[model samples]
Target: MYLTSSRPDIVHTTCLCARYQAKPTENYLKEVKMIFCYLWGTINTGLWYTKDSGFELTGFSNAYYAGCKDTFKSTSDGAQFLGEKLVIWSSKKQDCTALSTAEA
Candidate 1:
């Protein structure tokens, strides 16, 4: 949750991993380790909001049909920006299953 504020790229994978916390396996551990490795490699990269940027707000969203391997639920993600600065983002599994890409 903490990392999500600054690292939107990890949101979906992290959220997916979080869902298996109650019954984590070796694969899950490996995935977590991979995230740590990625963080280590990109320690110097980070978000930087500038005051000179425009004030326009923009947003984008997408859904992956049946993205969850375990539950066959779709995953939805979105990001919002204030001008050129990113202000909000989210990645989550949908509450209901999507039967097709269009539905997703």
Candidate 2:
């Protein structure tokens, strides 16, 4: 949830990985363990919202065409922010295939 809320660009890949969370295979488990290891190695890393950071808001969004192999669904990604502080991010696969980028 943190990653999804802080970095929308990773949502497609994260959700794709999450789909296998219910019945994780050995490969998926290994990947998850690797993430844990990475987290352990980066324990000192942190995000800071400084007082000097102005409260300017900005956002960006994007999508990939047919990113899901199983569903052939287009993935949408977006992020919202207040000043330099990230407020929200999301990535989700659409229920229907988009005929074009405009349709999406």
Candidate 3:
């Protein structure tokens, strides 16, 4: 969960694995290992911001209705940016069930 703040790319996969934390199977462990491997391979990768860049804030959001088969809950995700640099992001299951994408 902590890592997701800086590495948004792993948010979905990590959250999926997190759902199985109570009774993690081999597959869950494998998926976590894969995330670690990916991190190791991209240790030097990161976003950069230039001092002279334009100042702008932008946001994007999306949701999937009834995405979780176990709970029939929707998943919503969003990201915020300052110019070309990502400043915030999040991905989580919704509290209430969503019948459609718009509801989500």
* Model number with the top TM-score: 1
Of 1 and 2, the candidate ahead on TM-score is 1
Q: Model 1, stretches more than 4 Å misplaced?
A: none
Per-candidate local distance difference test: 0.92, 0.73, 0.89
Strongest candidate by lDDT: 1
lDDT of 2: 0.73
Better of 1 and 3 by lDDT: 1
Ranking by TM-score: 1, 3, 2
For model 1, state the Cα shift of residue 67 in Å.
0.5
> Better model by lDDT, 2 or 3?
3
Native-to-model Cα distance after best TM-score fit, residue 63 in candidate 3, in Å? 0.5
TM-score of 3: 0.90
Residue 94 displacement (Å), model 1: 0.5
The global Cα lDDT (0 to 1) of model 3 is: 0.89
**Residue 55 of candidate 1: its Cα lDDT?**
91
Error of 1 at 29 (Å): 0.9
